[model samples]
Target: MAVGVPELKIERVRQNYLANLVAAIACFLLEAGWYSAFMDTWINGIGRNRQWLENTGINPAIQYGTALVMASIMATAISCVTQLTGKQTALRGIKVGALLWAGFELTTLATEYIFEVRPISLFLVNAGYWFFGMTLMGAIVGGWKKKV
Candidate 1:
């Protein structure tokens, strides 16, 4: 019985891992596609008027889009973990999403420092982007149990 129990646990873990992988990949792809489409109108419209944005060669849409895609992937992965563990809740989803966003932000900041690139005011922009992005993903995944 002990051996069987261990095997069962391993199988469950494997299944959840696969599920999280699939969810993350799917979420990333979908969000990326959405961002690509959104960038066209966004860049030429609202972003064109900002002098700093123009001089910096930074595309707000692209940056925000990438952040959104990453946030979605992370939120989906967390949702999968929580679901598998039978502790799925909106608060847990939010916490996971926030952690994911923070992780990405730290990595980006570190990379920028290493490359000797000027900080592009990414902290504010990314914070807002990830907050909304992850919140939306969490709400969707935690609020809805439908398979992705």
Candidate 2:
């Protein structure tokens, strides 16, 4: 609509809510495994752990609910991106997901951690999850709609 962009028709679909839910669950489970495997180092780095969260009176429901919400948002966003780019297939989605991880997730998280003086290990752990998780989500969502 402006600048070097050309006008094009944007097709709208129901957006596949079921696919989004599946992707969300997949990513959430992946996150859980990732954190669990690295919990010792991760918790020491943050000086926090499961007991800390519980002692603070944080509800497990809140944590899970937040994860679901975030995963759903990621799924929907990837779907839109795939549709806009005319990208089909899980492989294509993986590429898009990588680019997004590099451009958006990596950049933002790195910047925040740098300022906070957090260790690079922490950043690597978190960013590594996003890197793989985003690609996995893209693969699932990409396979859902082969074409825009």
Candidate 3:
């Protein structure tokens, strides 16, 4: 309708909530296992131990809930980007996941680690978990498309 401007066609993206939920849960569980595996190194890297952690008075529910919520958000974002960019597939999702981690999560953590003088081991422990977790979630959500 405009003189030299083309009409913008907005396409609707159908989100698979089930896939997202599954991805989030998977991410959360991966976190648990990752941390458990690196518990000693993590505690040491933070300059604390089991005793300090137990005495921190942080509620387990809050911590777990936060992780779940964050994972859900990340999974949804990956799915959205995967769908918007091109044909949605497990490989695309995985690539998107890794790229997002490198672009956002890894960079952010690297800055914090540098400024806070945190150990590389700790960074690896935390960042590695996210890399794997996000990729796994991406694969799930990307592959599980909503029926048209």
- TM-scores for candidates 1 onward, in order: 0.46, 0.88, 0.93
Candidate 1, number of clashes? 0
| Ranking of candidates on TM-score, top first | 3, 2, 1
Lowest lDDT 10-mer window, candidate 3? 6-15
TM-score of 1: 0.46
Point out the higher-scoring one by lDDT: 1 or 3: 3
Over the stretch 1-148, how does candidate 3's per-residue lDDT look in tens digits?
9799999977667789999999999999998899999999999999998999999899999999998998898899999999988899999999999999999999999999999999999999999999999999999999998887
Error of 3 at 9 (Å): 4.0
Would you list the rank order by lDDT, best first? Answer: 3, 2, 1
The list of candidate 1 runs beyond 4 A from truth reads 1-75
As for lDDT, the candidate ahead, 1 or 2, is 2
Q: Which prediction has the highest lDDT against the true structure?
A: 3
| Candidate 3 Cα lDDT to native | 0.93
All models, RMSD in angstroms: 8.2, 3.2, 1.6
The alpha-carbon deviation from the true structure for residue 143 of candidate 2, after best TM-score superposition, in angstroms, is: 0.9
**Model 2 over residues 62-95: C-alpha lDDT tens digits?**
9999999999999888877876677467887777
After superposition, which runs of candidate 2 have C-alpha atoms over 4 Å from their true positions?
Answer: 1-7, 146-148
